[model samples]
Target: MSQIIGNLSQIGGDYDALFCDLWGCLHNGKQPYPAAVSALQQFRRAGGRVCLMTNAPRPNQYVIAQLDRMGVPRDAWDLVVSSGDAAQDAMFAGAVGRKVWHIGTEKDDGFFTDIPGEWANAPAISRVSLEEAEGIVATGPFDEANEAPEDYRARLMMARERGLVLLCANPDVVVDMGETRIYCAGALAEFYEELGGQSLYFGKPHPPVYDRARRLMDLGDEARILAVGDGIRTDVKGAQQEGIDCLFVTGGLAAEAFGPDVEDPDEELLREWLATQQMAPRYSIGRLR
Candidate 1:
């Protein structure tokens, strides 16, 4: 069961830090959510640290650049802990082998070159054809919006036959690019596993991303932390697995499922939806604010 709330302030004081999701709670893919921004600034004013924890399949700098283009102020967060950064660490450490086949677009180039300084001595990883590679690295599809997981079935079948492991950069099956829904790398990874191939994830609902956030941010050992996001399977489940409290935002990806009012969720419907889910947040809100 989950209690529906109106704003972050109602329980913000209980936590010393917030592990906030970027896509739906703080901003849409195009711009920042003003109310969410103010809530975060207030959290910081009260001496709380805000970590923009995200499952975007790009390094922190690339994400920061996108946030800048979207006009999200830097004051709203203390640091960014992203799945791309964590996955990059694994890639450099040879988790996916040295020679790999990439399934992504040019926008995802940063995943290979924009890694952290600690990996300066990392081995020189090369991009090879599917037939010549030892593993697969998926950031997203070449056509994120227009393609489906099944679109890669033929190629994936080849990789499966060769026993290539896929390193998933983002574990979100799909996300709303404003009003349009787009598939992410997680969909392909899911499809690969369904075809009997191994897929490794470094994002939400997985340990690597949370572990990376812990290593980067100093949210004091005694600090009370709360995870906030709209994705039930990713954000909420991830928080639970990490042994932390979570606040579910209904106005994001599953806005319609919670009722007609995206700003105010219908409690009965929310509870009913939760009953069907394997994971439920302790608290629920229409939006981050």
Candidate 2:
């Protein structure tokens, strides 16, 4: 069983650096959680370095701008690392000079620009149909609110028939927006794989993003870094694989699974869920604060 923690302060002394997830832990897509923002600010004030590691399918700069708009103070974190950065890096390294169909929202278009030549040859990215594409870069479903993995069945089938490779930018199966949980790019990627299509994932529960996070944090000791997030599949599993202590937040994405007062989750249910995953966090909290 994971120990329940009241706030980050209670376990502040245990870690020198914090690798915190951005989406559910700090905000719910619409706005920032005041308590969570303040907690990270406080953690930073106490000589702790915070890296806003996220699975957002956009570059770190884009995420920083979004954070600013959401009123998440710049002082709250020391650095930012995102799956978009990892995806870009991977694309630069592996997909250079290749053409790919961008399967995502209009808001996700920024992911294709400003490629640095120092890394790898910039590849040509298009929003054209499957017939014109050599591969696919799936950021997420274009219509998250009204769509599901099944909504992409036809398109994925077409891409699969074309023998296209898929690069999944945000490897999150679902995310909570207020009280609504919507399917993400990971779900589509999973479905595509189930259809015998080859897919590459770039986010939590994957080593590339974690390696990027570690490098961005520049923290020498992995053991001294504490990972904080809500997703059991991504955050908890990622931290465990990275050999870092993780603090799970229950009131974020998995709120419904734990029952009422999600901040103070039902221990038995939470434990059962963890048991199924064969993973556990060092500590659990209702929220990041």
Candidate with top TM-score is 1
Model 1: colliding residue pairs:
none
Sum up the clashes in candidate 1.
Answer: 0
Report the C-alpha lDDT of model 1 over 58-88, residue by residue, as the tens digit: 9988899999999999999999988998899
Candidate 2 lDDT over residue span 1-289, tens digit each: 8888889999998889998998889999899999999999999999999998899998888999998988888999989988998988777666522577877898888788757566544445445567787788889998988988887788888888988999999999998877788888999899999988989988998998878777766766544889999999999999999888999998887777788996688888888877887988989998888
Model 2: residues >4 Å from true position, as ranges?
A: 117-123
Of the candidates shown, which would achieve the greatest lDDT relative to the real structure? 1
Candidate 1 regions with alpha-carbon error over 4 angstroms:
none
lDDT, candidate 2, equals: 0.85
